[model samples]
Target: MSDRYAPDVQEERRAAIVAGLVTAAVGFTSSFAVVLAGLDAVGASASQAASGLLILCVTQGLGTILLALRYRVPVTLAWSTPGAALLATTGMVDGGWPAAVGAFLVVGLLVVATAAIKQLADLVRAIPTSIAQAMLAGVLVPLCLAPVTATAERPLLLAPVVLTWLLLAALAPRWASPAALVVALTLAVLAGDDRSGAVWPGLAWTMPTFSIGAVVGLAVPLYLVTMAAQNVPGAAVLTSFGYRPPWRAAMLVTGVGTIGGAPAGGHAINLAAISAALSASPEAGPDPSKRWVAAVTTGTTYVVIAPLAALLTAVVVAAPPGLVAAAAGLALLTTLAGSLRAALTAADRAEPAIVTFLVAASGISVWGIGAAFWALVAGVIAHLVLRRTVRAR
Candidate 1:
């Protein structure tokens, strides 16, 4: 018989709801700008950018629902924030937004292909943990620094937001970032900015236009970063929490979602790393079996809020850019700290990890490719050199 009326089950379900809501809020407030900035970098119009955001939310939301239900685990899905950061740094490409959409399609194919090819999946799995963590930390540096810079430049706008975050973080850890986001939204309303007007965002489709430069520079690097920096770590996080989800099936579903969303301006969607823990962790419920409820609730929240993408875009676009940055930085602070800790935990790999972090944080690009790819390359070389030196000694 089902334990539907049991007191423990009821408490677990309630906790799951809270976890899901918190995760959804954090996922939306934290990195939404990176997505917008990335689309803008690739020459998307305001309407197009809104469409992309909506598409991403919808697809990832659906993926989260499907995966959690199919696997009976908290399989959270998210757009690749690091991939978006790479796009932001890569600047405009030839053939504009269409070219970017083409790249997105190719990335989807690559993800699907990786699932089908054991060698490719194994190669991604072979990337050193320290290097991957370092790359993630580096990509997050600028975003994490936003609150510090905002405090200096826009104290009046950012002070309350930071104060709220600090207070909540001390007393109610999980809700701290979301509370800060609430403060930001409240302040944005009080500012009386006309640009904050609400309008429902409509879909805008663009035909894909493939260029060799776009394919090599954007598609390949995007696929690599999403897999290395997001999916792999996401799976590891789940494993750490004792959920052995079907990895290949999850990748296949994400790939299909990515492909479906590409023409509507969505970039890559993958397994979520930071936010996955919010739903999958023990705090979501005492019963491991009931934790999937949190993932389902998160997916429902995303789908419900997808249509409000235009309103959110307006709010962010209207707010003092510094204020928005501050909110985002605050949301990512915990993630940044965790990644840094993971990257530096190994004594032997520490130096190479630092190399990776610095290169990625530098935001330098060469031959139209972003710093993320180069950071991995540099870290690998540093690791090999250091190992050889130790052997000689």
Candidate 2:
């Protein structure tokens, strides 16, 4: 008999379905705008942006499904939200979209190589968690300020959305972000022009264009952020709950997925950090071994939702830019809070973490490299110097 019909398995199966649906809902509602904004920042056309979102959803969905089944673990995959935020802040490069695509491909290959090379993987793991969390917080600061900016600029339109989010967050935290999205959409339809009435997104392949600036500015940084902020933390989350997924295989799937989808505008896909906790924890099912079913269900939900990318892209493009930013900010508030808590938890790392957060939040760019990289470097140097001085004293 199927597991679903088995006497002892039915309850677990139902619990898994609930976990998976909730995870999928939270993941999609939280970061879709960041992806769109990132693509637009790099000069992708509306259809190209939609195609990227669709490709990302489909590839990550497939990767999650394959990895969960193969490993019998809750191997949830996600688009790199931090990477998207990085892209949004990085702005357009010399060769524009084509160059960005080239960077995406390079980042994917780097991830694959990182998995294959033991030392490289070890090096990634060696980066201080506090520094990484600080950098993430720094990168998120500007985006997180969007709600305030949106409220100032368009109070009538954005106020209700923010209020709804706050209300729901207090009452039903898991559903808060999704409800806020609904409020935003309803307001958009009522007040905004219907420019995207019949727009259907189509695939538009971009030829790769490589340059020193694009590689250093976009590719290297994208790879670093994806590994530092997403993959490493995601692994930790799973391990915390006692599921030991095959690390190399998980990286391989994400790397391959990223490379495959780059031509169609996808950036990086990695393991889910926050959302994974939802589907892999005890709340997912009483039996820990059955939690993989939640991940599989989440993956299936992503696949089913991939076709709606055109509609989402249309709505995003038509909506007020500030409103979209506000929604993204609202969605990420919890993540930001968690990152800050982690970054500041350790006393010795707190100063360097603050430095990193400030530099990244400043959004400075030098020699085409963004502030995220510089923030990480500065934070590490501070950490080392301060530690040595303390030892000498």
Error of 2 at 328 (Å): 0.5
lDDT (tens digit, per residue) of candidate 2 on 1-393: 885568668878899999999999889987898898889998898888898999999999999999998888997999999899888877787688999999999999999998899998888767777888888888888888999998998998898999999999999988888888878876776676766566575667898899777888788778988998889889999999998867899889999999999999999999999898999998789899899999999999998999888888888878876887788888878878878998999667488999988998898888877787788888989999988988999
TM-score of each: 0.89, 0.94
State residue 243's C-alpha deviation in candidate 2, in Å: 1.2
Worst-scoring 10-residue span by lDDT in model 2: 194-203
- Per-residue lDDT for 66-91 in model 1, tens only? 98988889989999887887787666
Clashing pairs in 1: none
lDDT, candidates in the order shown = 0.85, 0.87
Q: Please report, as a residue range, the 10-residue window in candidate 1 with the lowest summed lDDT.
A: 191-200
Among the numbered candidates, top lDDT falls to: 2
Candidate with top TM-score is 2
